[model samples]
Target chain A: MQVFELIIGKLLPYATLVILIVGLLYRLNRWQRAAVGNIALYPSAATRWRLFGKVLSEVTLFSSFRQENQALWKRTWPFHVSLFLILLGHTRLITDWPLRVGLGLSEGTVNAISAWGGGICGVVALMTCLLLLARRFGIQRVREISTGEDYGVLILLLFILLTGNAMRFFTHYDIAEIQQYFRTLFSTAPTQVPHDPLVLLHFLMVQLLLIYFPFGKFLHVPGVFYSKTLLAKDY
Target chain B: MEGHVQVNETELQTVIDQVKAIKNGPRVLQLYMDICAHCGVCAEQCHVARTMPESRTNPAARSDHIRQLYKRYGSTWGQVLKAIGAARDITEDEVAVWQRDFYECSGCRRCAKFCPFGIDNSILTRKGRAVVHALGKSPFMMSETQRISDETGNDEGQTYAAFVEACRFLCEEVKDDWDIDVEIPIDRKGADILFIPASADLVSFPETHMGVAVFFKALEIHDGTTWTMASTAFDGANFGLFTGDDPHMARKNQAAYDACIDLGVKKLVIGECGHAYRIAKRMGPTASHFGNPFETTNIFLLADEYLQKGVLKFDKRKVDEIITYHDPCNFARSTNVFEEPRRLLSAMTDNFVEMTPNRTENWCCGGGGGLAVMDGAEKVEMIDGTFLDYRMKVGKMKVDQIMATGANYCAAPCANCKRQLMQLMEHYETGVKIGGVFDILGNAIVLEETKVKAGAKVAS
Candidate 1:
C-alpha cells in the first residue's frame, strides 16, 4: 500500500507532468509542421471581430452545432459544460482559502461550496461523461467513427471521474494534508502524500491519462482552436 | 484505367509524396483531418449525398476516404499506429473507390457551408484528385480535355483557321439574327479588355457568344471600352481545377497570360465559365507565369457596373419571362460573383425571383468540378450505369430547387452549369428554358441607338 502510495501519490505526478508537457509539445509541433498555408475561413474584414467572437462563443455556446442539429447540441453542450464545472471545482484543491478571502466569502460559505457545490458538479460531470460515452454505442453513424482508441480514451476519463467522485462523496480526505502534499509535488522538495486509497487511485488515473493525452482523441481539446474556420479569413 | 494509369510502385510513391507535401493548402489541413466530430451536418448540404444512395455521398465519408490516406501515410507514427487499429490502411481496390468518390464530389464546396469548422472537404478532395492525377488516374474525360488544351491550346482542338472561321460565322449569325453588324476582333493589340471564354461556347451555345457581342457593343457606345478575344488562348476553363493538377493549371493560365500580354490589354475579363472565372481571377494571377499587372473582372460584375452607371440599357420587356438565376458554385461561393449576377438579372427582368437558398448557400447543378464536360449525357466512366442517369441523380436537388421557384427561365451563367442544367430540365420535363446570363443580356440589350465609336476612341 505504501509502495503504491509512493508511486501514484508521490513520484508519478511529476513524471506525468513532464510527460504531459513534452507530449503536448510533440503533438503541437506535428500540427505546426503539417499545417499548410492559411487555409482558414472567416467572414470579410468588416466582420473580422466575429471570428474571435465566434471561436469564443462556440467553446461557450456550441452555436455551430445548434445551427446544424438541435438534438446533438443538447447532449454535446452539457457534456462540455459539466466538464468545465468539474475543472472549476478542482480549483478548490490548489488554494481555496486565498480565493475565498479574495471573493470576501466566509469560511462557512466556502465549506458549503466545497461540500455541496463541488459534489453537484462532480455528479453532473459523471452523468454527462457516461451519456457521452454511451452516445457512440447508441448511433450507428457515430459508431463507424468511434475507434478502440476513442473508446479507450473515454474509458480512462470515466475512471478518472469515477475515482474522483468516490473521493468527493464516500472517502474522507484531509484537506490540509492533501494541499501540502500537492505543494510538495509541484515544488522542488518532496514530502509524504495523503494516503487515502480513492485519492491515490484518482491521482494515478489522472497521471496515466496525462501521459497518454497526445496519443489519442484527447488531442481534440486543443484541436478545436485550430479548426479551419476559426483560423480562416474568408469563406 | 485505360491508357495512362496502371500505377506502379514508384508512381504510387510519387503520388503519395505530392499529397504529404501539400504546401498550398492551410495548416488547418491537419485540424481538418483531426477535428471532424462526425456530426454529419454537411450530408444534407451535399446534392450527391441527398440524391445518390450507391455512392455514400456523406461528406464525412468522402472526407474520411482521403483522411484515411492521410492518417495511414501522412506520418510515421500514423503508419506504425495503423497496424494496431489506431488508423486503417487504404487498399488497392479502395483506390478505385477513392477516385470515383473524389470525382463524384463535383468539388462544389457547399459542404463547407454547414461544416462547423469550415473544413472544406473539397480542398481535401482536390488534393486526393491531385494525387490520383499524379498517378495518371484522373477520369479519362478530364485528362482528355487537358490533353486537348495542351496540344491545341483550346478544349475543341479548334485550329487557328477553324477558330477564325467560327468567329466569322458567328458574326454573320449576329448580323442576320439581331441586325447588328458585330465583329469578334481577334488578337487586337492595346484593347482595354481581353475576353477569354470557354471554347465550347462558340459552337455548342452560339447564343452566348451572340449575347457577349451585343453586351460589348453596348459597352462600346456607353463605357468607351474595347475588347478582343485571342485566337490561341480563347478558352478560359482550366481543367487543372477539375483534375487537381497544379502544373497544368499554371501552364494553361500562362497561355491566357501570354494572350493578355500579346494583346497588351488594360484588363482581363473572364467570361461566364464559373471555374475558369475562379481560376483566372483568384488563382491565375499567382498560378500564372507572368504576374497579373492589370485588373481581372468577371464579365457579369463588369456588366452590372455598366448598367448601374447608365452605360448599358436593357429593354426588360424583351426578356419578359419570369426569370430565376442558378448561381454557379464557383461564382456563388468561391469567387463572390453572386450579387453581380443577381443585380444584372434584376436589370434585365421584372420577374426575377430568388431560389430558396440563393447565392453562397445555393445548390450546385451537379455539373461542377468538370463534371459537365464529362457529359454523362453520353458516357459514364468505369461504372455499369449511364452517366446521364448519374448526373440526373446528383442534379435531383437542384432540379427540385428550380422547379419550386416556378420560374420559366433559368439564366445559368456558367457553361458547365448550363449543360448539366439543360439535362435536368429535359429529363425532368421541367419546361425551364436554360441559357447563359449573357443570353438574357443579348435578348434584352438595346443596341439600335448604340455605336462602335467607343471602340474607335480606344483604338486611337
Candidate 2:
C-alpha cells in the first residue's frame, strides 16, 4: 500500500501529465486539421471583436443555455462555476503562491478561507452534480439521449467530490507537507504522500480523470470554444 | 421499420465505408460527433420532438444514429471507448432508422440555440441523409425533385419555353390585376441584376413573382438598374441541400453562376425562397470565398433598402388584413434575414403583429428541408406514412404560434414555407391566409409611374 501510494504520488503524475498534454494536443490537432464547411448559424456577430465577446460570454456565462432551458441552466451554471472555483482552489494542494500569497493573505487566513470558501464551492458542486445525475435518471428525454459515459462522467465527479469534501471537512493535513510532496513529485524525487486514505483516493481519481480528459466529453472545455466560433460567427 | 429498404451485404459494406468516410470528414462534424453531452436540451427545442413526442424525433436521438457508427469506425481507440458506452458498430436496422428519422428533422437549427455546446444536429442530419442518398434510399419526392432539377434545371420541370410563356403570362396578370405595366425581362444581357426565385413561385405563387417584377420595375425607374430572369436558370430551389448531395448542389449552383456570367449581370438577386438564398449566398459556388464575378443579395434586403431610402411608395391602406411574418428556418436562422422582412412588413401593413418567438428563435413552418415539396405516399415507391401527414403533425407548433398571434395573414416569404403553411393552415382549418412577403408587397405597392407606363405601352 505504501508502494502503491508512492507510485501514485511520485511516478504516475508524470505519466498523467504527459498523457494529458500529449492527448489534448493530439485531439486539438485532429479538430484543427479537419475540413470546415461554411455552416455558421446566422444573426451571429458580424465583427471579430463581437464574435470574441459572444463566444466569451457563452463560455463564461453559459448565455445560450440560459436563454432556453433556465431550469437546466440554473443547475448547470452553478455546477460549472463551482467546479471552476474548486479547480482554482486546488492550488492549495500545490503551491499557494497565486491563490494565497498573491492575495497577501496569511496562512491562517488562507486555511480558514479555504475551509469556508472551498467548503461552500465543494458543497455547491456536489449538490449540483447530484441534481444533474438525478435529471439524467429522472427525465425520460434526457435518459433517452444519455449513454453510459454520461452516467459514468457524473458518477465519477460524484466520487471525486465526495472524497474531496471528506478531506476538506473531516480531516486536517499540513499544507506545507502536501505542497512539499507536490514539489518533490514535480522534481522527480520520491517523497512521503499524505497518509490519509481519502487524500490518496482523491489523488488517484483526479489523476484518472486527467488521463481520461482529452479522450472524452471533458474536451467540451476546448470544444465549446471551437463549436461556438464555428456555429455563430457571421462574417 | 415497416416498408423500409433493405441492403444486401455488399451495399452494407459500402455504407460502412461511407460512414467511415464521414467519420473522417469535417472538423465541426467530428467534434460534434465526439463531444455531445446528450443533455437533451436540444429535444425540448426541437419542434418535431415537441409535437411528435417520440424518442426518434429528438435531435440528439436522431443524431445518435450517426454517432453510433462514428464511434465504431472513427478511430482505433474507439473500441476501448465503447466499454464506457461511447461506441457502437453500424447495423442494418440503424440504417433503416436513418432513412425515416433523418428526413423527419426539418433542419431548422433551432436546437443549436439552446445546445450548451452549440452542436448543430442539422449537420449530422445532413450527413445521415447523405449516407442514405448514397444508397439511393432518399424518399421518392426528394430523389424525384433532384432528378427533375438535374434534368430541367428546376424542380418544377417547367421547360424553357414554358418558363418564357409563364413570364409573359405574369406580365399580363400584373397588368390586369394591379393595372401596372411591368416588363418581366428574360435573359436581358448587361442587366445589372439577375433575379432567380423558386420556380414554384412561377406556378404556385405567381403573385410573389409579380411583386418582384414590380419591385424591379420600380428599381429601374428609381436608378436605371435593371434585372432579368435567365431562361436557362430561373429556378433557385435546389433539393441538393435537402438530400445532402454536394455534387448535385454544386451543379445546380453552376447553372445559376453561368447564367450570371452569360447575361453579364453585376448582381444576382435571389427572390424570397429561403434555402435558395442561403445556397446562393453561402453554400454554393457563389459563396464569397469563391470570388465569383457577381454579388448576391436578397429581395428583402433590396426592398428594405428602398423602404429605408423612401424611394418605393407602399400604400399600407391596401393591405387590410392583420399580417404576421413566419420566419423561414433558412431565412431566420441559416441566413440571418429575419429583420429585413419584418421591417418591410411593418411598412406594408399597419396591423403587423409578431408571433411570440419571432426572428432567429422562431418556430419552423413544418415544411422546411424540402419537406414542403414532399407529400407522403404521393408515388407508389414511398415507404412509411405520408410526409404530408408528417408535416401537418410536426407543424402543430407553428399553427399554434400563428393562432396565438390572431393574424389574418401569415406572410412567409420562402416558396417552401408558403406551400407548407398554406397546407398546414388548410389542414388545421386556421382561417389564415398564407403568402410570401412580396405577395403582400405586390398587393400594396402603388405604381405612380406605372399608370403612365401602361398608357405608353397601350399607345405603342
Candidate 3:
C-alpha cells in the first residue's frame, strides 16, 4: 500500500503533466493541419473581427445557449464559472506568496477569500454537474444525441468535484502540507508526498481526466479556433 | 432491421472510403468532425429539424451518421477499434438513410447561428453528398443537370441561336408594352459587364429577361455602362455546388467563367441567382479548377453601387403594390447580398414591410439546394409509405411567414427562392406574387433623367 501510494501520489502527477502537454500538442497540431476549407458560418468578412469577441462571450458566458436553451445554460454557465473559480482558488500551490499576496492582500483576507470562493464554487459545481447528469439521462433530445462518452464524462467530473469538496469541507486535511507536496511536484523530485487515501483517489481521477482531455469531447477547447463560421465572421 | 432496398456491398465500401478520405483537408472539416458536442441547440435553428424533430432529423444527429462512419474507418487504429467493438460499425442502413437526409438538407448553414461553437453541419452534409456522388447515387435532378451542364456548359442544353431568338422576342415585347426600346445585346464584344441569367429565364420566365433588358438598357442609356449577354455560356445556375463535387461544380461554372474571358468583359457580375453568386464568390476563385481573371460579385453589389451613385431611378407610383422581400438562404447566409435588394425594393414601393426574421435568420424557401429542380414526390416514398410534395411540406414555416407579412408581392432575388416562393404561394393559396428584384424594377423604374435624388433618398 505504501509503495502504491508513493508512486501514485508522487510520480503519477508528473506523468499526467507529460501526457497532458504532449497529448494536447499532438492533437492540436493534427487539427491545425487538417483545417483546410473556409466554412465561415457568417456570409461576410465585414464583421470578421467580431469573431473572437463572439467566441469570448460564448466561452465565458454560454451566451448563445443562454439565448436558445435557458434550461441547459442555467446549469452549464454556473458549472463552468465555478470550475474557473476553483482553478483560481488553487493558485496557493504555485504562487510565491500563497493566495496571491503579491497583489498585496493580507493573510486573513486571503484565507477568507479562499474559504468563501472555494467552498461556494465547489458546492455549486457539484450540484450543477449532478443536474447536468440528470438532464442527460432524462431529456429525450439530449439522450438521443448523447453517447456513453457524454454520461461517463459528466459522472467522472462529478466524482472529481465531490472528492475535492470532501477534502475542502469535511475532513481536517492539512492545507500547508498539500501545498508543500505540490511545491515539490514543480521541482525535479517531489518529497513528503501526501499518501492520504482520499488525496490519492482525487489525484488518480485527475490523471484519468487529463489523459482523456485531448481525445474526447473536451477537444472542443482546441477545436473552436478552427471554426469556419468564426473565420467568415472575422476574416 | 430487415431491409427492403437491396444494399450494394461494393458501392457501400466505396462510400465509406470517401467519407474516411480527407484530401489536403482544410482543418475546418477535421475540427468540425472532432469537436461537435452533439448538442441539440443547432436543431432549433434548422428548418428541417424544427419541422421534423425525429431521430435523425436533428442537425447534429444527421451529421453524426457521417461522422460515425469517418471515425469508424479513419485509420488502422480506428479499424482495430471497430473490430473490438470499441466503436460503432458503418452499416448499410445508416448509409442508405444518410442519402435521403443529406439530400433533404438544402446545405443552408443557418444552424451555425445558434451553435455555440459555430459548427457548420452543412460542410459535413456536403462531404456526405460528395461521397454519395462518387458512388453515382446523387439525386436524379442534380445528376441530370450536371450531365447537361458538362456537355453544353448550361443546365438546359440551350444553343446560341435559341438564346438570341429569345432575346429578340423580349426586345420587341418591351417596345410594344412600355414604348421602351431596350436592346438585349447578344455576344457583343468589348462589353463592360458579362450578364449571365439562368437559361430558363429566356424560355420559361421571359418576364425576367424583359426586366433585364429594361434595367441594363437604362444603365446603358443613363451612365454608358455597357452590359451584354454572351451567346454561349449563358446560364448562371451551377447544379455542381448542389452535388458537393468540386470537379462537377467546376464544370457547371466553367461556361460562365469561360464566357467572361471570351467576351473580354471588364466586370464579372453573377445576376440575381443565389447559388450561382455563392459558387462564383465563395468557392469559385480557388475551387473552380481554373481561376476567374476578375473578381466576381453579385448584381446586388453593382446595383447598390449604382443606387448610391444616383445612377438608378424608380417611379414609386408605378410600383403601387405592397412589397415584402424573401431572402434566399444562399444570399442571406452563404453570401452577404441581403440588404441591396431590399434597398432597391424600398426605393420603388411606399408600403415595404419585412418578414419576421429577415437577413441571415430568414427561413429557407424549401426549394433551395436544387430541391426546386428535384420535384421528387413521385420518385421517393416516405417511411410512412405516403407520397408528399416534399418542398411544400418542408417549406411550411416559410409559407406561414410569407402569409403573415400580407404583402402583395415577394421580391425574391435568387432564382431558386423565387421558384420555391411561387410554389409555396400556389400550394398555400396565399394570393402572393413572387418575382426577381429586377421584375419589381421593370414595373416601376422611371426612364426619365430628373428623379435621381428622390430615388436615392427613398432607397434608404
Candidate 4:
C-alpha cells in the first residue's frame, strides 16, 4: 500500500497538468478548424461583447432558468453552485495570500469551510449524477443522443466528489501535511511525503478526473460557453 | 378531367427512386431525424404560434408532427417498443392534415434564426410538403394555383392585354395624382429596367403599383419596361415556394426569364414582392429553369442607389405622420437589403421607428412564402389565423412600439407584408394605416422647384 501510494502521489499532479493543457489545446484546435468555414460575415466588436455578457450570465446565474421544470433546475443549480464554491475554497492550494487577505479566517475556520463545501459538493454531485442517469434512461430524446462516454463522465465525477467528501468529513485527513507536500513540490524540496491514505486516494481520484475530463462530454463545461457565444447568437 | 386522373406510377417511382438515391439521403434524413432539442425558442419566435395561440401550430410543432413519422419508423428502441400493429399505419387523415398544415406555412424560415440547435424546421416542412406532393395529396389551393400558373402566365388569370391595361391604369393614376404623364412602356426593347410587379399589386393592391409609377415619374428615368406575359409567369408570387414543388417552381421561373429574353431588356427589376425578389436575386440566376445566366439587378437595390445618388427627392411634409417599418423576412433575412429600405424611410419621414427584432431578426408578415395566395377556407384556422399568431405577437409588439411613438402609419416594402399588416392592425384595433415604403416616398417626393429645408421636422 505504501509503495502504491508513493508512486501515485508523485505522478498524479504532473499527469493532471499535462492532461488539462494538452487536451484543451487539441479540442480548441479541432473546433477552430470546424468553425472557420461557418463564420458570420460583418461581425462587430459590440456583438462580441454582447455574446461574452450572455455566456457570463448563463454560467454564473443560470439566467435562462425558468419555472417550467423547477425540479430539474433545482438539482442543476445546487450542483453548479456547490462546484463553484468548492473551486473557490481550493484557492489556498494555488495562493496563500488570497485566503489570508480575502477570507480573513482562522486555519480551523478555513479548513471547516473547505470540509463543509466539499460535503455539499459531494451531495449535489451525487444528485446531479442520479438526475442525469434518470434523464439518459428515462427521456427518449436524451437517451437517443447519449453515448457510453456520457455515462462514464457522470460516474467518474460522482466518484471524485464522493471520495473528496469522504476524505474531508469522515477520514479527517491532515490538511497541513497535504498542503506542505504540495508546497514542497512547487518549491522543488523533494521531501519524503507523509503517509495519509485518504489524501492519497483524493489525489488519485483528482488525477482520474483530469485524465477523463478532456476526452468526455465534461469538455462541455467550457464548451457550452464558447458555443453559446459563437454559434447560437449573431455574434 | 376523368381521363387525366390516371396515376403516373413511373413518375412516382422516379421521384421516390431519386429521393432514395440522393448522395447524402441517409445523412440528411438522420440529421433531420436527430437534431431537435425542443427548447421551444422556435415556437416563441414563430408568427404562427402568436397568430394561432390556441392550436399552437408553430414550425417547431410542425417539425415535431413530422418527426412522429420517423418515430413510427422504429428509428429508436422506445419508438419500436411503442410501435404495435395498428400504430404503424400512416392514415389518410394524417395525410390530409399534413397537406393542410404544410400548405398553410409560408416557408419564411424565421423559426431557424431562434432555434437552439440550428435545426431548420422550414426544410423539414418542405420535405413533408414534397412527400405530400409525391403522394398526389397536395391541397386543392396549391394544385389550383399551380394550374393557374401553368396555364395563364400569372397566378391571376390576367391576359397580356389586361397586363398592359393595368400598367396604363397605373400610369393614369400617376397622371391624376402627380399631374405627370409617365409612360409605363410595355415590351420596349433595350430598356434599362424590366419592372415585374406582383399580380396582387396590379389588381387588389393597386396603391402599391401606383406608388412605383409615381416614384418612376418623379425620378424622370424613362428607361423601364414591363412585360405583356399576364399568364402564369407574370405573377412573381411563386406558390411552389410554399408547396415545395421544384418542377412547378422551375416552370414558373422559366416563363418569366423567357419573356425577359424575348423582350431583350437589360435588367429584370422584380417589384415589391419579397419571395419574388428572393427568387430573382438568389434562385432564378442559379437554377437550370432560368436557362443560362442572364444579368439582372434587383429593383430594391436599384431604388436604393437612385435615392442615395440624389436622383429622387421626396418632400417630408407630404408624409408628415409617425410611421414604423416592418422588414419582410425574404427581403431582410434571405437577402441583405435591410439598411436600404430603412435609409429610404428615414429620408422620407422623420417619425420612422424600427419594430422590435428589426433587420435580420425581423418577424415574418405571415403572408410571404406563398401563404397569402393560398385560399383554402377550411385550412384558414391552421394557415392564416393560426400561422399568423407569432406574426400577430410581432405585430402586437410593433403596435406597442408604434403606440409609444404614436405612429399613424406602418410602411412595408413587400405587398404581402403590407396586406398582413393591414389585417393585424384591423384585428388588434390599432387604427394604423399600412402602405408600401414607396407609397410613403411617393407622397413625400419634393418637386425640383420646391425649397429644401436642411433639417425640417414634419409634425404629425
Best by TM-score: 2
Q: What is the C-alpha DockQ of each candidate?
A: 0.40, 0.79, 0.56, 0.05
Candidate 2 error regions (>4 Å): B1-7, B378-384, B458-460
- Sequence-dependent TM-score of model 2: 0.96
Report the poorest 10 consecutive residues by lDDT, candidate 3 chain B. B378-387
Compose the digit string of candidate 3's lDDT tens values, residues B198-300.
7767776677678777887667767677888887768888887777888877765766777788888877777778788777766764233345565577678
* Native contacts present in each candidate (fraction): 0.35, 0.81, 0.64, 0.00
User: Looking at the true structure's interface, with contacts defined as alpha carbon pairs within 8 Å between chains A and B, what fraction does model 3 recover?
Assistant: 0.64
Highest lDDT scorer:
2
RMSD of 2: 2.3
Q: Residue pairs in steric clash, candidate 1?
A: A35-B27, A36-B26, A36-B27, A39-B26, A40-A232, A41-A232, B376-B388
For A1-235, candidate 1 gives per-residue lDDT tens digits of: 9899887876777788888999889767767776354333223223668677776776678665476577666666776787777777677667665867889999778778778877877787778778767876886555655566667766888898888888877877787788777766777786688777788878888777778676555666787766634434453
Model 2 docking grade: medium
Q: Give the winner by TM-score: 2 or 3.
A: 2
lDDT of 2 by residue, B409-458 (tens): 99998888999999988998989998888877877987656555754464
**TM per model?**
0.89, 0.96, 0.92, 0.64
Interface RMSD of each: 3.8, 1.1, 2.8, 8.9
